[model samples]
Target: MKAIQISQFGSNDVLTYTELVKPQLNPGEVLVKNRAAGVNPIDWKTCSGGGAAPFIGDLPFIPGWEFAGTIEAVADDVEEFKQGDEVFGFIRFPERAGCFAEYIAAPADQISLRPDGLSAEAAAGLGLAGLTAWQALFDKGNLQASQQVVILAGAGGVGHLAVQLAKWMGARVVATASTENHEFLKELGADLVVDYKNESILDHVNNVDLVIDGVGGEVGIDALNCVKPGGTLVTLPSVTKDEVIAAGKAMKVKVEPIRAEPNCDQLDRLAGLYADRKLVLQIADTIPLEDIGKAFDASRTGKVKGKLILTL
Candidate 1:
């Protein structure tokens, strides 16, 4: 099998596309022949010695977490799925699953059957980002219907999905994005779009029940002001600073940082939404598996409007 692996952490040039032995399955695991792999910031960040890099042990590591593929075989303990089943999910996030290769041995409970109408590229894009948005809004933030919410980086992978999910839950959605993407976000069900480049997000919106902060740092810290006195502020990126938590406390608001995990139940709900045409995935670009280096470069630019995928 052909895979992109890194013997050492550095730039995108370090990702080498070469042949590697097909992975063998373990108990309660399924061997998937990957058809598409999502290229997330975590992928490039890990490769450059950031994000989840510390969890990646040894050299010659393969970086990728979200993928969609067909099941080639299953371990003895697995009973829910059989060979030739189409599935998609985030594989063992915060731990290495080596999804950049053609085959991945993922736990059966971490994945679900793909919606019939959903393409492999689209399914690949949904796992990590979709789970991140869903967990941030519903589980951590406790967002409710008819409430107002603000989503930062509305055009991003997680942010875009957050906008749609919030709308589906009947929340009045307000989002921050560049002027160029304002219309795009509105189409995704955002009721109001704040132009982060030209206008202050705090000035345009206030007294929101929840704020999903996808762009952590000073921006995420500033979003604390957008929430109401008792509202919650959920930060998605693990890179959130300590000051954000302190600031939220001072403001009498709940501040939480979230890391998306593998959840087959949540993935099933997202897949149902896709089947009903209530959710849509935006694909910024799809590159061949051999050109993963260029995909990393594009992800590093931080300007992609949607998810990038690697087709096998």
Candidate 2:
């Protein structure tokens, strides 16, 4: 099988495309012949010795966690799927799942059947971002119908999906993006779009029931001002500053830092939304497996409006 492996953590140059032995399945696992893989910030961040790097044990590590593929084989304990089933999901997150390859041995419960009419690239892009948005809004923030919710970085991978999901839940959606992306977000069912570059998000929006902050740092802390008293602020990134926590406490707002996990149930729900055209998966670019280095370069630009995918 062909795979991209990093022998050392550094720049994109370290991601080497080479042949490797096919992975063997364990109990409750399935061997998938991957068609596409989602490129996330965590992929490059881990390569640069930041996000999830410490969880990777071996030197030559595969850095992808989300994929869409067909099941080639299944373990003895797996009965939910069979050979030739099309599937997609976030693999073992916060651990090595080896998704950026032609093949991946993933736990069967971590994936769900691919929705009808959804393409492999689109399915691959839906896993992490979709799950993150769904969990943040429904599970953490407890966003409800008719509630006003503000989503930061509305044009981003998670933000774009968050807007649609929030809208699907009947929440009034407000989003922050550049002026150029305001219309794009509005089309995704956002009730209001605030241009973060020229305007202040807090100035344009207030008394929100929930704030989903995909952008961390000072921006995330400042988002608390948009939330109403007793409302929740869900930060997608794993790392949150102490000041942000303190500020949320003082404001009587719930501050929750969320790390998206592998959940087949949530993926199934997202698939249904995609099939119904309620959720749209945006792909900024799709690179071949061998050109993963270029894909990483594009992801680091922080200018991509949607998810980047690696097509095998």
Report the lDDT tens digits of candidate 2 across residue range 26-125. Answer: 8899999999999988899999898888788878898898999999999999999999999999977424448998989989889999966899999999
RMSDs, each prediction?
Answer: 1.4, 1.5
How do the predictions measure up, each by TM-score?
A: 0.97, 0.96
After superposition, the stretches of candidate 1 with alpha carbons farther than 4 Å from their true spots are 93-96
lDDT tens digits, residue span 1-312, model 1: 989989888997798988888877778899999999999998888889988888878777889999999999999999999999999999873233578889898889899999788899999999999999999999998989999999999999999999999999999999999889999999999999998888888898889899998888889888888888889999877666467787788878899988788999999999899889999999999999999988888988877898999999
User: Which residue pairs show collisions in model 1?
Assistant: none
Error of 2 at 45 (Å): 0.6
Candidate 1: deviation at residue 305, Å? Answer: 1.1
Scored by TM-score, the top model is: 1
